[model samples]
Target: MRLTMLTFGLFAGPAFAQPGPPAEGPDEIVVTGQKRDGTLQDADASITVLDAEAIDQARLRDFRQLDDLVPNVQFNEAGQLSNVFITIRGVESNPFIVNRAAVYIDGIPFRELTNAVLSQVESIEVLRGPQGTLYGANSESGLIVIRTRAPSRDAEGEVRVTGSLFSGTGGAGIEAYYSTPLVSDTLAASLAVKYGREATWMRNRAAGVTEPGEIEERFVHGRLRWTPSDRTTLNATAYLLDINAPGLFDNDFFPQDRTLYDQLYGALNGGRPSGRYGYFHDAPKRTDETEYVLGLSVAHEVGSGTVDAAVSYRRDRSDSLGLDFDFTSLPTAAGRDDNDQRVTNAELRYASAQQQPLSFLAGVAYFRDDKDNQKSTFVGPGDLDSYVAAPVQTRSIESLSGFGSLRWRPAFVRDVTLSAGLRYDHTRQRAVQREGQLDLGGGSILYYTDARLASTDDAWLPRFSITWEPTDDATFFGTIARGYIPGGFNLAATQENITDPDVLRYRSETMWSYEIGFRVRSADGRFRASGAVFQIDSNNWQEIRVLTDETGRPVSSDFIGSSASIRSRGFEVEASWRAVPGFDLSASFGYADATYLYLFNGIEDLAGNRVKLVPEYDANLSARYQHRSGVFARAAMNFVGAMALDERSYAVQPATTMIDLQLGYENERFTARLFVDNLTNVRRFSGLGFDNLAFGTDGTVYGALEAPRIVGAEVEMRF
Candidate 1:
């Protein structure tokens, strides 16, 4: 039989149902998306939602599976999964997120802003553009929300095991859901646990490569619900996550030709091996992070409206282990002393009656975050050759913000709602780097206190959105918003300066966006459709530039209107169809035009500058099907357009295509699935080149490789 894409009708989908109205499931109302508890379709901002079912369907284990799912969201992770290159809507691509994005798990925020691996995520929501009011932190571009499933109230449990060929490794997971009645009329409790591990797909014929490096993660979620009387409920939920990922960076090739290596000898340069057959064989580098979160929420009915309050707290700690940095770079065997984060938030909301044609929600929030980060360096004896005590850097950051929004329904229009929001933020940030003069015997003598300087910043953001319903089955909306990112000290800018220091303090950035979208579904609810168009005007954006100032410590330079402008315009479209009984299909595609609008300096870049690794056009299209007969099969594919690597729009990474196929079967108690990612073994660079120019030494941080094509299968049975 010929396979076809899921076809759709003309009607838009349904409006998001508010709580108490009861529509859809828990997965639709993720806190990280809108923080308003609504479906992505009803949300005021642009968002991408990836649910566990969809995650499993795609045979996803890591962020590779997340690529292109969201129009401009790409993994910015480097050397290890501990760093985050997360930018939203090209807001902070070659620059930095500073304020472009903020990450959250449940209602608690992850204070550390790095390209870290996501662990225990039941669903990942990417909110495009600035989200300063609803989410705190540096949410200038938007936000990335990760929601982990909580323990269920009703008792249920399962265990799954899968073995795949290639790495000779097996994967296993056991999950338990238990609920116990407490105090009969007052309380009930629930708990859950999950764990899994797999082997690496890449084979290194080079020296030093070994075993046990496949990605592995474990998750725990638990909660308690208490009801003292009707119309009132109290809930407390807590969760823990532990994740370990081996070295993440891949080297594509060297800049100069390999034949030069033969003539130059190892002396011509570091004379590293041929980049052609690069491999990782030495001790594997690792990033281990653990996060814990707990939240308490209370809901009470007040007349026609409802009053709800929630308080949440979370702590995340990360540690880097082993002899690793990036490939071809110095072996960085180091650790940090203060790699910890803490966040606390409290919110009160008044929601109007949903049954009434006109209803609105007004909320106010207060949040506080404290973080301590310290960097340590240790040089290795083998290939590194030269050795010295690595410098130590410490950072402390804090922020506070407030937000408000109002929604109104017009008397003339029964299905349309209009909303507006405004938010104010104040933050205090400080960084200190003290160079140490420890002797070989280990007696420490502090060298430079002037090497450390501190600074502070403040800002405000505004947003507006409108939702219109031509009919009960169709909805349309438009949004306009302003976003920003905070500035900080650049470590590289310092070392580059010996007598003079690189200037300190990088300022904040702001970007404005306008968007219109539509969601439609057929009368039978069998077919669904949604689409959107957007244009973003970026102001005072940030990017790296070689400066002559000795104190020019790579700082966040504020553009007082010299035209560091950028324009990002794009379209998002999707369709979901049930088509036939017991058979389901879905497909989505997007088009984008991302580019710098103005030339910062009349001096055209000769190296052919491209801002960062944002592609002009990128898309993802997938199709999956399951038969009512309890038999299922699936096939999917991904497409990527060429991306620019520099600011002058000069260097470019050629684009490529990939295809994946999946097959699965499910019975009363068992299920099996076979999946292939990049089935054709297409290898691509996950992102562009980046470097710490302050070294006073040139470290060619270029051509970082990404995930190779992977083909694997999974099988599971529940009892």
Candidate 2:
């Protein structure tokens, strides 16, 4: 069967694309749920597809390790990559950078949902729950559709590159991608780029330092499409990102010093970086991103069905420059600038035309976000950072939305089928603030912010699904959802006593999800399995209160909302088997028994905090082999199972597994790839921390996760 679908598409490319030939059959699949065109066992809910040959054989530069290989998904990123936690089934994450997952690149919807990134990806449709109607707002706990690689309608495009090596003072980098087509059927375009430099396997103590803090990333994208007939279409896209990293493996912001992190992990029990710890330094950060997109699509018919339309526009800009202290003896540093955003969105829809078994959808959307900022904090040089400059903040956002959906196949449940949707959003917010004091020849004065303390909010989201197929490869599903996240104004300052309590009185978090899934394909195609069970019900639960002082630094706090109650139940299993044709075996297992049933008022020290960087159980196993002239070989293993580091609750960070190897070769255009990650050069620590040694408060930090086991390769050419 086409070499078993190209050895199951070589588990999605990290080097050379595989999984070729499938214009039909393999049980037809391509879905965004009720957005239309179903098949993934008739789409009902719960979806996970990586593809792109598993992002070039898992060289994955921030695929967030595919979050435990998918299931109750959770991927947290801090420091340089900033806050990127795309949680699912956990009901939504609320740490910082207000992004509770809601990203899209294909149907356009990414005005900064934490700028989800995964270079040149061609497929990555996560979709867990509460995707209002067709997906709107932060989506509460689901939706991550990032589909790139467009601009080839009648012919070619290809390019590839890879590099990596990390064990101690991290360093190694590279990645690239390309595509083309100009008038073969209208217009086309594509692009991808990446760069890296690594160092900082941590051990910085007084000039006994070594090369510390290093990492850099760059991204670019372009797209254009147009078709006049055979149904209509138009598309325009743009993207850019630039970042300078000096710390990317955040060990959850150190300084809760546990004997200085057990004397720096017993002075390197898992050692490397032999330069006797010399040259360690801190305080560095720089990030910038720019994006703009334009889109249009149309389909016409009418008589029986087929009448679809879509429209969109977007503009975004994000900026950051660092060292305010992840520590290097906190010399208080800052050179920040944010010219936030200006966005626009438009969507018009109509579905149900063609050969109808009944289909429908509608839409109207508009959005605007604006911001400007400039800040400063310095010491020792440049005239005290130019006398402490200022212009702190400015913000604005305007939104209006409407959405709809429907699908039917009612005829006495001929194997049943039904889908539903709804979405409504109305938001208006404004904030302008500035405050930085210290004068009388000490220079530094800025205070401005108060325009009747602006704010506004409104949202209504709902989505439903049900799909049952007695046969067709087997399928069963059910879903109920409600999600949304957006609430602002809090530059820190929490009041507990004497007058002062208007940090824009923020609060708004809602979630309700219930899911069930099972999709099987066996009959004779070897094997493919999917199973899921989920439960999410949350209220308020946006908690963060760290106002330390007395050497704990940070004395600004105001990020509250907690009638606190969170519950997430999960179970997921994934499978793939061919075992004979060219050899293949894929497996995944997940189990998340989350907690925090409720907590309010009495704080009770957060009564049992077992929900941070969750890891109840996780596993992934792979075996691959393919040859016919397009050589291939694979062996993989990744497992993580213990974590939970903070929230007034004790500590834990254990459970490690890493064994990866991949080799590839392709033809018909040109392709090559190689891989190896922690292939046993093991020296683990992927986050989960604390060490508050009794008031003498030791303070130590280490964040350089799995790099010492290095390897890299990538090459591509197509046209």
Q: Highest lDDT, which number?
A: 2
Best by TM-score: 1
lDDT of 2 by residue, 1-719 (tens): 00000000010111111233444446354554345545456678778777677665554555555674676676654433444556565543534445577766566655344423355566777887778666677767778765555556655545554454443434454545555667776665555555555554434442322324554555555555555554445555555555554432232244333354445443332232223222223334444455445555545545554455555555555555443332333333334445555555555556553136667767677766676766554542222124355555677778788888777778877888787778888888777665443221113222334333467788888777788889878888888888866666665431222225443355666778888888888766578788888888777666555444465434332345445667778878888888788778888877777666765423364645666667777778878787878898888887877766445435555777888887988777877777776688655444334332112234443332333465666666665
**lDDT scores of the candidates, listed in order:** 0.55, 0.56
By summed lDDT, which 10 consecutive residues of candidate 2 come out lowest?
1-10
lDDT of 2 at 516: 86
Could you report the Cα RMSD, in angstroms, for every candidate shown?
7.2, 23.3
TM-score of each: 0.79, 0.33
What is the alpha-carbon lDDT of model 1 when measured against the actual structure? 0.55
